[model samples]
Target: MPANFTIVTLGVADLDRSARFYRDLGWEQRGDQAEGITWFRTSGSWVGLYGYDALAEDAATEPVPADELPTYRGVTLALNLASEAAVDLAFARVQEVGGTIVKPAARTDWGGYSGYFADPDGHLWEIAHNPYWTVVDGRVDIGAT
Candidate 1:
Protein backbone atom coordinates (compact mmCIF):
# COMPACT_ATOMS: atom_id res chain seq x y z
CA MET A 1 0.00 0.00 0.00
CA PRO A 2 1.09 3.50 -0.61
CA ALA A 3 2.10 5.47 2.50
CA ASN A 4 0.94 9.03 2.42
CA PHE A 5 -0.86 11.64 4.46
CA THR A 6 -2.47 14.48 2.56
CA ILE A 7 -4.12 16.57 5.24
CA VAL A 8 -4.66 16.92 8.95
CA THR A 9 -7.73 18.84 9.97
CA LEU A 10 -7.97 20.08 13.52
CA GLY A 11 -11.30 20.86 15.10
CA VAL A 12 -10.93 24.22 16.74
CA ALA A 13 -13.39 26.00 18.95
CA ASP A 14 -12.51 29.30 17.31
CA LEU A 15 -11.29 28.89 13.77
CA ASP A 16 -9.85 32.40 13.57
CA ARG A 17 -7.87 32.04 16.76
CA SER A 18 -6.54 28.63 15.78
CA ALA A 19 -5.59 29.86 12.34
CA ARG A 20 -3.80 32.84 13.84
CA PHE A 21 -1.93 30.57 16.22
CA TYR A 22 -0.57 28.47 13.39
CA ARG A 23 0.12 31.53 11.31
CA ASP A 24 2.22 32.88 14.17
CA LEU A 25 4.15 29.63 13.94
CA GLY A 26 5.04 30.61 10.35
CA TRP A 27 2.62 28.47 8.36
CA GLU A 28 1.56 29.86 5.00
CA GLN A 29 -2.03 29.90 3.91
CA ARG A 30 -2.84 28.10 0.72
CA GLY A 31 -5.60 28.94 -1.77
CA ASP A 32 -8.64 30.90 -0.62
CA GLN A 33 -9.90 30.78 2.95
CA ALA A 34 -13.34 31.09 4.41
CA GLU A 35 -14.85 32.40 7.63
CA GLY A 36 -15.13 29.07 9.37
CA ILE A 37 -12.17 27.35 7.80
CA THR A 38 -8.54 28.04 7.11
CA TRP A 39 -6.02 25.89 5.23
CA PHE A 40 -2.28 26.12 5.42
CA ARG A 41 0.54 24.52 3.53
CA THR A 42 3.02 22.89 5.83
CA SER A 43 6.33 21.39 4.88
CA GLY A 44 4.65 18.25 3.57
CA SER A 45 0.99 17.85 4.36
CA TRP A 46 -1.71 20.44 4.66
CA VAL A 47 -2.75 21.55 8.12
CA GLY A 48 -6.29 22.74 8.42
CA LEU A 49 -8.35 24.42 11.10
CA TYR A 50 -12.10 24.51 11.00
CA GLY A 51 -14.86 25.72 13.26
CA TYR A 52 -15.86 22.96 15.63
CA ASP A 53 -19.47 23.12 14.57
CA ALA A 54 -18.55 23.14 10.91
CA LEU A 55 -16.32 20.13 11.29
CA ALA A 56 -18.87 18.19 13.29
CA GLU A 57 -21.61 18.98 10.84
CA ASP A 58 -19.43 17.91 7.93
CA ALA A 59 -18.75 14.59 9.66
CA ALA A 60 -22.38 14.19 10.72
CA THR A 61 -21.34 14.20 14.35
CA GLU A 62 -22.20 16.38 17.29
CA PRO A 63 -19.79 19.13 18.04
CA VAL A 64 -18.17 19.08 21.41
CA PRO A 65 -19.44 21.94 23.51
CA ALA A 66 -17.12 24.89 23.31
CA ASP A 67 -17.68 25.93 26.93
CA GLU A 68 -17.75 22.39 28.29
CA LEU A 69 -14.00 22.10 28.69
CA PRO A 70 -12.83 19.20 26.59
CA THR A 71 -10.00 16.94 27.65
CA TYR A 72 -7.09 15.61 25.66
CA ARG A 73 -8.91 12.31 25.24
CA GLY A 74 -5.63 10.57 24.34
CA VAL A 75 -5.30 12.50 21.12
CA THR A 76 -2.02 14.23 20.41
CA LEU A 77 -0.72 15.80 17.23
CA ALA A 78 3.00 15.15 16.95
CA LEU A 79 5.67 17.23 15.25
CA ASN A 80 8.88 15.32 14.81
CA LEU A 81 11.98 17.44 14.65
CA ALA A 82 15.27 16.76 12.97
CA SER A 83 17.48 16.75 16.07
CA GLU A 84 17.56 17.42 19.78
CA ALA A 85 18.45 21.01 19.07
CA ALA A 86 15.55 21.34 16.69
CA VAL A 87 13.26 19.92 19.33
CA ASP A 88 14.34 22.62 21.73
CA LEU A 89 13.93 25.29 19.11
CA ALA A 90 10.40 24.22 18.23
CA PHE A 91 9.35 23.92 21.86
CA ALA A 92 10.75 27.33 22.50
CA ARG A 93 8.68 28.68 19.68
CA VAL A 94 5.60 27.07 21.15
CA GLN A 95 6.18 28.89 24.41
CA GLU A 96 7.05 32.14 22.70
CA VAL A 97 3.80 31.93 20.77
CA GLY A 98 1.73 31.61 23.96
CA GLY A 99 1.33 27.83 23.99
CA THR A 100 1.46 26.25 27.41
CA ILE A 101 4.17 23.70 27.89
CA VAL A 102 2.61 20.48 29.10
CA LYS A 103 5.96 18.72 29.50
CA PRO A 104 9.53 19.78 29.48
CA ALA A 105 11.78 18.58 26.69
CA ALA A 106 14.05 15.84 27.89
CA ARG A 107 15.51 12.45 27.11
CA THR A 108 12.88 9.76 27.32
CA ASP A 109 13.31 6.27 28.69
CA TRP A 110 12.12 5.12 25.28
CA GLY A 111 15.38 6.47 23.80
CA GLY A 112 13.99 9.64 22.32
CA TYR A 113 13.72 13.29 23.28
CA SER A 114 10.25 14.73 23.48
CA GLY A 115 7.89 17.20 25.09
CA TYR A 116 4.31 18.31 24.98
CA PHE A 117 2.35 21.53 24.68
CA ALA A 118 -1.25 22.58 24.54
CA ASP A 119 -2.53 24.82 21.81
CA PRO A 120 -5.14 27.50 22.41
CA ASP A 121 -7.91 24.94 22.21
CA GLY A 122 -6.23 22.66 24.75
CA HIS A 123 -5.29 20.22 22.03
CA LEU A 124 -2.11 18.40 22.96
CA TRP A 125 0.87 18.55 20.69
CA GLU A 126 3.95 16.38 21.07
CA ILE A 127 7.22 17.63 19.69
CA ALA A 128 9.80 14.90 19.51
CA HIS A 129 13.20 14.07 18.16
CA ASN A 130 13.88 10.37 17.81
CA PRO A 131 17.47 9.58 17.08
CA TYR A 132 16.48 6.38 15.30
CA TRP A 133 14.31 8.34 12.89
CA THR A 134 15.19 10.20 9.75
CA VAL A 135 13.37 12.95 7.84
CA VAL A 136 13.50 13.43 4.11
CA ASP A 137 12.05 16.61 2.68
CA GLY A 138 10.44 17.46 6.02
CA ARG A 139 8.60 14.18 6.50
CA VAL A 140 9.97 12.07 9.35
CA ASP A 141 9.86 8.30 9.36
CA ILE A 142 8.62 7.44 12.83
CA GLY A 143 9.15 3.72 12.21
CA ALA A 144 12.64 3.87 10.83
CA THR A 145 14.45 0.55 10.97
Candidate 2:
Protein backbone atom coordinates (compact mmCIF):
# COMPACT_ATOMS: atom_id res chain seq x y z
CA MET A 1 0.00 0.00 0.00
CA PRO A 2 1.12 3.54 -0.70
CA ALA A 3 2.10 5.61 2.31
CA ASN A 4 0.00 8.60 1.45
CA PHE A 5 -3.31 10.00 2.56
CA THR A 6 -5.56 11.64 0.00
CA ILE A 7 -8.26 13.22 2.10
CA VAL A 8 -9.88 13.29 5.52
CA THR A 9 -13.61 13.83 5.68
CA LEU A 10 -14.98 14.82 9.04
CA GLY A 11 -18.64 14.40 9.92
CA VAL A 12 -19.86 17.57 11.53
CA ALA A 13 -23.16 18.29 13.28
CA ASP A 14 -23.62 21.81 11.94
CA LEU A 15 -22.24 22.22 8.45
CA ASP A 16 -22.26 25.97 8.53
CA ARG A 17 -20.65 26.22 11.94
CA SER A 18 -17.90 23.80 11.03
CA ALA A 19 -17.39 25.49 7.71
CA ARG A 20 -17.15 28.86 9.38
CA PHE A 21 -14.63 27.53 11.87
CA TYR A 22 -12.28 26.33 9.16
CA ARG A 23 -12.76 29.54 7.24
CA ASP A 24 -11.85 31.50 10.36
CA LEU A 25 -8.62 29.51 10.48
CA GLY A 26 -7.49 31.10 7.16
CA TRP A 27 -8.61 28.25 4.94
CA GLU A 28 -10.79 28.78 1.88
CA GLN A 29 -13.03 26.15 0.35
CA ARG A 30 -12.03 24.66 -2.94
CA GLY A 31 -13.40 26.34 -6.06
CA ASP A 32 -15.50 23.35 -7.13
CA GLN A 33 -17.20 22.72 -3.80
CA ALA A 34 -20.60 21.09 -4.20
CA GLU A 35 -23.81 21.23 -2.28
CA GLY A 36 -24.08 19.32 1.03
CA ILE A 37 -20.28 18.88 1.29
CA THR A 38 -17.58 21.45 1.78
CA TRP A 39 -14.00 20.82 0.64
CA PHE A 40 -10.90 22.62 1.71
CA ARG A 41 -7.42 22.06 0.35
CA THR A 42 -4.52 21.72 2.74
CA SER A 43 -0.82 21.65 1.93
CA GLY A 44 -0.81 17.98 0.95
CA SER A 45 -4.39 16.77 1.17
CA TRP A 46 -8.04 17.74 1.08
CA VAL A 47 -10.33 18.10 4.07
CA GLY A 48 -14.03 17.51 3.69
CA LEU A 49 -17.00 18.40 5.85
CA TYR A 50 -20.33 16.64 5.59
CA GLY A 51 -23.42 16.31 7.74
CA TYR A 52 -22.73 13.94 10.66
CA ASP A 53 -25.95 11.92 10.44
CA ALA A 54 -25.74 11.73 6.69
CA LEU A 55 -22.17 10.56 6.79
CA ALA A 56 -23.06 7.86 9.30
CA GLU A 57 -25.93 6.72 7.14
CA ASP A 58 -23.66 6.58 4.14
CA ALA A 59 -21.42 4.24 6.09
CA ALA A 60 -24.43 2.15 7.14
CA THR A 61 -23.86 2.96 10.82
CA GLU A 62 -26.03 4.66 13.37
CA PRO A 63 -24.87 8.10 14.44
CA VAL A 64 -23.59 8.55 17.99
CA PRO A 65 -24.53 11.62 19.95
CA ALA A 66 -21.63 14.08 20.03
CA ASP A 67 -21.79 14.28 23.82
CA GLU A 68 -21.48 10.51 24.09
CA LEU A 69 -18.24 10.22 22.16
CA PRO A 70 -15.32 8.84 24.13
CA THR A 71 -13.01 11.45 25.61
CA TYR A 72 -10.10 9.93 23.76
CA ARG A 73 -11.03 8.91 20.27
CA GLY A 74 -8.76 6.30 18.74
CA VAL A 75 -7.49 8.78 16.20
CA THR A 76 -6.16 12.30 16.33
CA LEU A 77 -5.13 14.61 13.51
CA ALA A 78 -1.88 16.49 14.03
CA LEU A 79 -0.32 19.70 12.81
CA ASN A 80 3.44 19.61 13.26
CA LEU A 81 5.40 22.80 13.57
CA ALA A 82 9.05 23.70 13.14
CA SER A 83 9.44 25.19 16.59
CA GLU A 84 7.85 25.53 19.98
CA ALA A 85 6.98 29.16 19.30
CA ALA A 86 5.20 28.08 16.16
CA VAL A 87 3.18 25.58 18.13
CA ASP A 88 2.21 28.29 20.59
CA LEU A 89 1.09 30.56 17.74
CA ALA A 90 -0.98 27.80 16.17
CA PHE A 91 -2.69 27.07 19.50
CA ALA A 92 -3.45 30.74 19.88
CA ARG A 93 -5.06 30.79 16.46
CA VAL A 94 -7.21 27.81 17.37
CA GLN A 95 -8.39 29.57 20.53
CA GLU A 96 -9.13 32.72 18.59
CA VAL A 97 -11.38 30.73 16.28
CA GLY A 98 -13.35 29.18 19.18
CA GLY A 99 -11.66 25.78 19.27
CA THR A 100 -11.72 24.04 22.65
CA ILE A 101 -8.24 23.70 24.09
CA VAL A 102 -8.00 20.25 25.60
CA LYS A 103 -4.60 21.14 27.01
CA PRO A 104 -2.24 24.06 26.69
CA ALA A 105 1.12 23.66 24.99
CA ALA A 106 3.88 22.45 27.25
CA ARG A 107 7.24 20.71 27.19
CA THR A 108 6.83 16.97 26.78
CA ASP A 109 8.71 14.17 28.48
CA TRP A 110 10.10 13.30 25.08
CA GLY A 111 11.63 16.77 24.81
CA GLY A 112 8.97 18.22 22.51
CA TYR A 113 6.20 20.76 22.85
CA SER A 114 2.54 19.94 22.22
CA GLY A 115 -1.08 20.65 23.03
CA TYR A 116 -4.53 19.47 22.03
CA PHE A 117 -7.63 21.26 20.80
CA ALA A 118 -11.02 20.16 19.54
CA ASP A 119 -13.13 21.47 16.76
CA PRO A 120 -16.83 22.18 16.97
CA ASP A 121 -17.59 18.55 16.15
CA GLY A 122 -15.15 17.46 18.86
CA HIS A 123 -12.49 16.28 16.42
CA LEU A 124 -9.14 16.13 18.17
CA TRP A 125 -6.23 18.17 16.81
CA GLU A 126 -2.68 18.08 18.10
CA ILE A 127 -0.37 20.98 17.58
CA ALA A 128 3.19 20.06 18.26
CA HIS A 129 6.86 20.78 17.59
CA ASN A 130 9.26 17.88 17.76
CA PRO A 131 12.84 19.02 17.79
CA TYR A 132 13.94 15.71 16.29
CA TRP A 133 11.59 15.90 13.36
CA THR A 134 11.79 17.81 10.12
CA VAL A 135 8.74 19.79 9.09
CA VAL A 136 8.72 21.12 5.57
CA ASP A 137 5.88 22.47 3.45
CA GLY A 138 3.26 21.12 5.87
CA ARG A 139 4.76 17.67 5.87
CA VAL A 140 6.46 16.09 8.90
CA ASP A 141 9.20 13.48 8.66
CA ILE A 142 12.31 12.35 10.43
CA GLY A 143 15.58 13.13 8.74
CA ALA A 144 18.54 10.74 8.68
CA THR A 145 21.12 12.41 10.89
Which candidate ranks first by lDDT, i.e. highest? Answer: 2
Clashing pairs in 1: none
Candidate 2 displacement at residue 55 in angstroms: 0.9
Over 90-109, each residue of candidate 1 has an lDDT whose tens digit, in order, gives 98888888888999899999
- Once fitted onto the true fold, the runs of candidate 1 whose alpha carbons sit more than 4 angstroms away are 1-3, 142-145
Compared with the true structure, the alpha-carbon lDDT of candidate 1 equals: 0.83
| Residue-pair clashes per candidate | 0, 0
Off by over 4 Å in 2: 31-34
lDDT of 1 at 94: 85
Best by TM-score: 2
Kindly list the per-residue Cα lDDT of model 2 for residues 5-116, writing each as its tens digit. Answer: 9899999989889999999988868744358889988888989999999899999999888779975789998889999999988888999999999989999999999999
